[model samples]
Target: MTSVLALTAATAQADAFNRIASFPTHLNNAEANAESSAEIISATADGMTLVYSDSPLEVIGLIDITDPANPKAKGNIAVGGEPTAVSVIGNTAFVGVNTSESYTAPSGMIKAFDLATMTETAVCDLGGQPDSTAAAPDGSFIAVAIENERDEDLGDGRTGQLPGGFLVTVDVVDGSLDCDTVNVIDVTGIAEISPEDPEPEFVDINAAGEIVLTMQENNHMVVATKDGVINHFSAGQVDLENIDATDERGALVFTESQPNRLREPDAVQWIDDNHFAIANEGDMDGGSRGWTIFNKDGTEVYENGTGFEKAIIAAGHYPDKRSDSKGVEPEGMEFGIFNDTPMAFILAERSSIVGVYDLTDPSAPVLAQLLPSGVGPEGAVAIPGRNLFVTANEVDLIEDGGVRSHVMIYELTDAAASYPQLTSAGTDELIGWGAISGMSAGAGSTVYAVNDSFYGYQPTIFTIDTATTPATITDATVVTRGGHPAQKLDMEGVYFDGEGFWIASEGRTDRMIPHGLYHVDMDGNIDAEIPLPAELLAVERRFGFEGITRVGDTLWMAVQREWADDPENHVKLVAYNLETEQWGAVHYQKADPDTGWVGLSEIVAHGDYVYVIERDNQIGGAAVTKKIYRIAAADMVAAPLGDDLPVVSKEEVRDLIPDLTSLNGYVVDKIEGLAIMEDGTAWISTDNDGVDDSSGETYFWSPGKF
Candidate 1:
């Protein structure tokens, strides 16, 4: 069954996971700019606290989740090595730390710490690098995946390197980790590929004291108890059709194929004693781009195929840059039962989203919801007793001056799913969309939106029906030339006139994309193109027209940043008289940046006022200038382009930071789209940066009347 988030808000309200809070990992460190990550996460026995492996900080971070809606930073403790995975039994935390000197001679330790005191209690030498750890349900023992991972630079990056990996079982004596009772079980020579060097990726123990293991690089799987290996099988391969198999081309094309793609499972979780699920996040040779459920005997009970990736694409979270390697990259899996329903949480690593699958029928699981996540979700834990679920995002963009990693908390309640504030889930085809730059209120209860240059080859005008609760994209009209996808267009602004549209293209002369305007008919055929005048073109920078609005016979455009001739913290509101064919400008004073440069992103004229979205390049806690400002329509008087310009007075309409963080996510930087309808309702949206170096979250909402 090809279902991608088929549940609507009305149907999902019976029971659903809604995000309540986002805690930044850097908050645990004293330094504000410290780089940290929340990789593998586990909850305490009481489900009142959480612990996660932070590899970059060489520590394990702790959080007090007694109040799931307001998680507090319990601080991090130095483990003296790279913490790769963690699991909690009772009040003690078991952390797998990699102290490997090199890939040829792997060395690791299972470190135990008291969560209440944050002090080291014990350490067990594992003699190999550990990747994942799982605690038994009854607190009897713990399982660790000893992945003596191969060096990618060495040879073809295959798994058959020296010092093959194995499994370690540690007995929990008296409800605590007993390092002296550590036992090793050989897991080599069990699979068809790279049997000598079995790189165990993840492990999960069922109630029957059996461990389910996935050797990702070796393309193998195994089921073993403390005694020895019971069963083993190849992860096998899949034949995929209608997938985007090309990367870094700045487009979304899903007509390619990967035949016999290897299903290199990365993370596995036990659905029950007889069955388990694995996320097929491949290594070097393959990534099936989906998840699968398997019986203990290695028989496939269900395989999602391309259904999960299709849902991510529809939610505008598709990472086209990783398409050739893995589409959406399903890397983490969590199984939990909340309110008498078995649910599976599948995380898309590259897309930064979680696919909620209702496993009422393990053989025919249904895609129930898709929740937005922080960038690069690597681990997840479910506390069903408290009706809660959590995710540890591992990507920290400190070097890129972006948002830090975060641990997001979600609670199951009788309320609608708040994420995917906008979606194209029910579209006819796979309408892949992102980087929503501008919008215009269309006729009736509809809105017209446009994607920026991220999808350069697929310039589109999206028709959104606001009549729905979260709004829905009903149609996508591709702007074309001679019946083919247009070229050299960086559509940043769009205005839907009664009969057609006027689009603005931001210039990047370095990339051969010119700064200009286009007049198109309703059929998306370009009727005319208008280039910038010599006066404006000679003084242009990378920042150009961000939005456009029509007032009588004059069309006004908002420039993103100040040009050469503009004053400090002042940008031009360029205007073109359609009847006179003349160009002129008026100045709009913008805010002085507290951290980074601030500028305008959109402009919309409604009634007797003109609204604009002014924001800064900073994100998360560093954000300050995301707001809406308006100017009286009577104050917009344009002067000659080469002469002195008059500055228009503006009033602060609204502060958008509150609404931006309403969904319990890090504040995104781009507040690009704004639409004002005839009923005094104004809609606002943020750009997802085409899911590159971003959380792939687009916040679309209405501030009532801004």
Candidate 2:
């Protein structure tokens, strides 16, 4: 008889052991999850899987589920696109790719291959981009989710945009039919829930072909038929009985709360046919905890426990879990057979471990064991034929210009057993050099990693390698890029088009200013540095440039204004086209001495618009508004030519720039960096400057139509 352990009792949190106990003094700079929807999930034979890539480019990884409690390292695959999800049927695996570069084509690629042989078969370019995908039950078709964005520029310098996400069915078997393979199924109503707009976090298709589960990440649940469009439903509104429930059909609806104060929703999972569970793990300060179990009809049958309420009862201590638990950010999850029974595989996202839990009882999940080898586990899948589970552990951080990642595999004796022993499937590392930030892989052992400097001052880049071992930097070498000493510059944000690396730089230290653009060649050589206007540079010196994004051949920058005594002074976004040498601006009202202008800071471009981050004045007793601004390229088409730029008094301009005041209802903080998304939204990061309520805060905003 298979061992039956009580899997629903909360594991005793015994003093909260540090997962990184060996690697003390590890860097712990936490940035908010700017793009939540693009988590790529792939599994290898070693039971390893790729979760979410931290960098701006593509990341692929693996996890070990052979022993659900002991997931270990395999390696990472660095592809050139913004990879969102992975699907495998038999030996052939399909990868979904996305691109966030504004100037580049909005294209996606599907890489199909024989995972068993590790051989490349075909590369299909999906002109219609995709975010995540699920394989059909019979393996004849694939349900791919694509997102189309619309920007609505608010005349007041702030713009808003909404996501129009849809699903496409792609044929996996016939590579020739891949060109005209997609069949569109609109998911706008299911995804567009918020007045501001809603983004789909993750979408999965069941093996039985009965239901497709799409986790919106922030809001409700979206359920669709195999060939039917997804029908949106709130987690609070899920009617379980309306559909047939099974690990194959109903197992995708699990919920886990965010561990941070940002209040993003938790990861979700499905327990069984009659029961589904949502983990309300709560955000920072142990905000909330409990499992909400619902029947087929969507009624809350019971809540087993609250956050620390249950943890305290089991182990004791006010549990402090952030959204991405440093131990594991709960993002990717899977429920499959274990030892002839169903088990839940949860990747403690960001955490280097895959958790095996007995979810037979939906109300309370018993922690079977914590697998300890994977890094950044996002998604996991179990293969019954081989009795193996695989996870993608994305580890794309460059400490000293080296890449370190592995595709780990784990083998299990029983596919339906709750927690069996996990064994390795031989780790395969995708070795290469340069600072890796993100990764993805294509057919024929093609691996990619987004490369960027750890310091905020390096050129954004992506490096390609085909090594079967984890990537690493063996020596400390001086590198030159973009006509500048790579060692001397500060840079962040990187993307990889199929041809070359698409990089962006925050440019400077100051907040309210504009910076120049620089491009790096494939051989790590700096080809050009498009300088900003001397006059603009002079004015920006008082402020500082933030985000530099590529939208096709043109680059966009958000120009945040400095503070002044008359709070009404404002901020602006400046767009510079690399192709046409044209520039434009989207201006916001200077804060009324009574109201604050809190100028825009970090700005990134997406498609046709630029999104800018706004921060309040740094000085206390000033405007308190904290918002992001969205500017369109159309409105900012005509810019002041640099050749005919005007000369200005630096001393006077600097003095006036600092004296600007802001309006009420806004916080006056030093808003710093920016990043753009493929879906036209923008991300902003602020500087603390040793101030209160101002450290480590990130914001997301989008541009509207011109």
The candidate maximizing lDDT is: 1
TM match of model 1 to true structure: 0.97
Instruction: List TM-scores for all candidates, in order.
Output: 0.97, 0.42
Of candidate 2, the 10-residue stretch with the lowest lDDT total is 20-29
lDDT, candidate 1, at 646: 98
Which residue pairs in candidate 1 collide? none
Q: Write the per-residue lDDT of candidate 1 for residues 573-600, one digit (tens) a residue.
A: 9999999989999999999999879999
Q: What tens-digit string does per-residue lDDT give for candidate 2 at 1-706?
A: 1111111111233211112111100111122222212234544433333232323434443333344434443334455676667776654567777764431234577666555444557666655566666676567777666643333234231112334445567676653125356666555544324424334444555444534444343345555664674345555421111111112110111233322222123444445544454443323222133334555345656543332122221111111222223112345566676656566665544334455666666656666544433334545555545455555445433332112232334555322222111111122421112222222222233322333333223233322222211122221112355355454343333333445443444445443223455555556566666666654555554443444455666555544564221123544445566676766544445344444335544444555555444555533333354444455545544436333222111110011112111100113245444443333222222332211112111111112111
Q: How much is the lDDT of residue 224 in candidate 2?
A: 60
**lDDT of every predicted structure (CA atoms):** 0.90, 0.40
